[model samples]
Target: MSWVLGNLDVIGGHAGAHLLQALPAIVLAFVLALPVAKLAGRLGVLRGGISTAAALMYAIPSLPLFIVLPIVLGTSIRSMVNVIVALTLYGLALMVPAAIDAFRSVDGDVLRAATAQGYGPVARFWAVELPLAGPVLLAGLRVVVVSTVSLVTVGGVLGVPSLGMLFVDGFQRGITAEILAGIVLTAAIALALDGLLVLAGRALMPWASAGKAPAEPSPAGAPDPAAAAAGGAA
Candidate 1:
C-alpha cells in the first residue's frame, strides 16, 4: 500500500501510456476489419481463406511476435510502435471474424426488402446491413477492448511502459503491494472500459432496448371465440 501510494504518479503515467497503445490499435483494427469482413461476407470463396489467415495470425505466441514485430517493421525493440503494431495485428485477427459473423447474422428478409426498395449495395450496407449488425459488432468491440487492455500489460515484459511494469518492479523488489496494486488497477481499467462500450452500444442501438409489447387480451365484455367453438363442438 505504501509502495503504491508513493508511486501513484508513476503508476498513473504507465496506465495512461497503456491506454495510448491500446486505443489506437483498437480503433484502427475496427476500421480495417470492417472492409475485410464485409468483403468476406459478400464473397463466399474468400471467407475460409480470410478466417484461416486471421486465425494463424492470432495463433502466433505474443512474446515472440512482439520481439519479431520490431524487426519486421524496422522499428527499435524499445519503441512503443512495436507494441502498437503487434497489438493491432492481434486486434484485427480477433475483430475480423467477429465482424464477418455480425454481417452474416443480419436477416435475409431485411436484406431482400432493402433490395426490393431499390437500395443499392452501398446504400443498403450503411442503412440496413450495418445497423442490423450493430449488436454483434458491439459485442466484438467489447471483446477487443478487454483483450487489448490485458495484452498491453504483456508489453511491460519488454520494458514497454505500462501497468505491467508494476509487476516487473514488484517482483524484482519482492514488494507484494506493488504487484497487488497493478493487478487491481488493471482489472478496474478493463471493467471501466468494458462498461463504457456497453453504454455506447446501447446508445447506438436504442431500438434494441425497446422490446416487443405483450399481446393484448380480448375486451372483458367480448365473447370468447375459443370457448364458443368448444361449446359448439360439444
Candidate 2:
C-alpha cells in the first residue's frame, strides 16, 4: 500500500504512455483492416492467403518480434515505434477475421433489398451494411483493445515506456508491491478501455438495443366481445 501510494505518479505516467502506444495501434489496425477485409471477402482466392498471413504474424512471439522489428525497420532497439508496429500487427491479426465475419454476417436478402431500393454498392455499404455490421465489428474492437493493453506490458521488456516497466523493475529488485501494482493497473486499464468501447457501440447502434415490438393481442389470448355477444344471444 505504501509503495503503491508512493509510486502513484510513476504508475500513472507509465499507464498513460501504455495507452498512448496501444490506442493508436488499435485504431490503425481497424482502419487498415477494413480494406483488407473487403478485398478478402470479395476475392475468394485471397481470403485463405490473407488469413494465413495474419495468423502467422500473430503466432510469432512478441518478445522476438520486438527484438527483430528494430533490425527490420532500422529503428532504435528501444524505440516505441517498434512496440507500436508489433502491436498493430497483432491488432490486425485479430481484427481482419472479425471484419470479414462481420461483413459476411449481413443477410443476403437485406442486401438484395437494399440494391433493389436503388442503393449503389458504396452507398449500401456505408448506410446499410456497415450499420448492420456494427455489433460484430464493435465486439472485435473490444477484443483488440483488451488484448493490446495486456500486450503493451511486453514492450516493457524492451525498455519501452509502459506499465510493464514496473514488472521488469519489480522482478529484478524482488519488489512485490511494484509487480502487483503493474498487474492491477494493467487489468484496470484493459477493463476501462473495454467499457468505453461498449458504450461507444451502444451509442452508435441504438437500433440493436431497440428489440422487436410486442405482438398484438391474439383473439385466443384476449376476451372476444363478438363471441360473448353471440353466446349471450344464443
Query: Which candidate comes out best when scored by TM-score?
Result: 2
lDDT assessment of candidate 1 = 0.89
Overall lDDT per candidate, in order of appearance: 0.89, 0.91
For 66-92, candidate 1 gives per-residue lDDT tens digits of: 999888999988788988898889999
In candidate 2 the C-alpha lDDT for residue 217 amounts to: 42
Show model 1 residue runs off by greater than 4 Å. 216-234
lDDT of 2 by residue, 1-234 (tens): 898899899999999999999999999999999899988989988887887887677898999999999999999988889999999999999999899888888898999999999999999999999888889999889999999999999999879999999999999998899999999999999999899988988899988999895675467887566677888999
| Candidate 1 least-lDDT 10 residues | 214-223
Clashes of each: 0, 0
Instruction: Kindly report which residue stretches of model 2 are placed more than 4 angstroms away from their true locations once superposed.
Output: 213-234
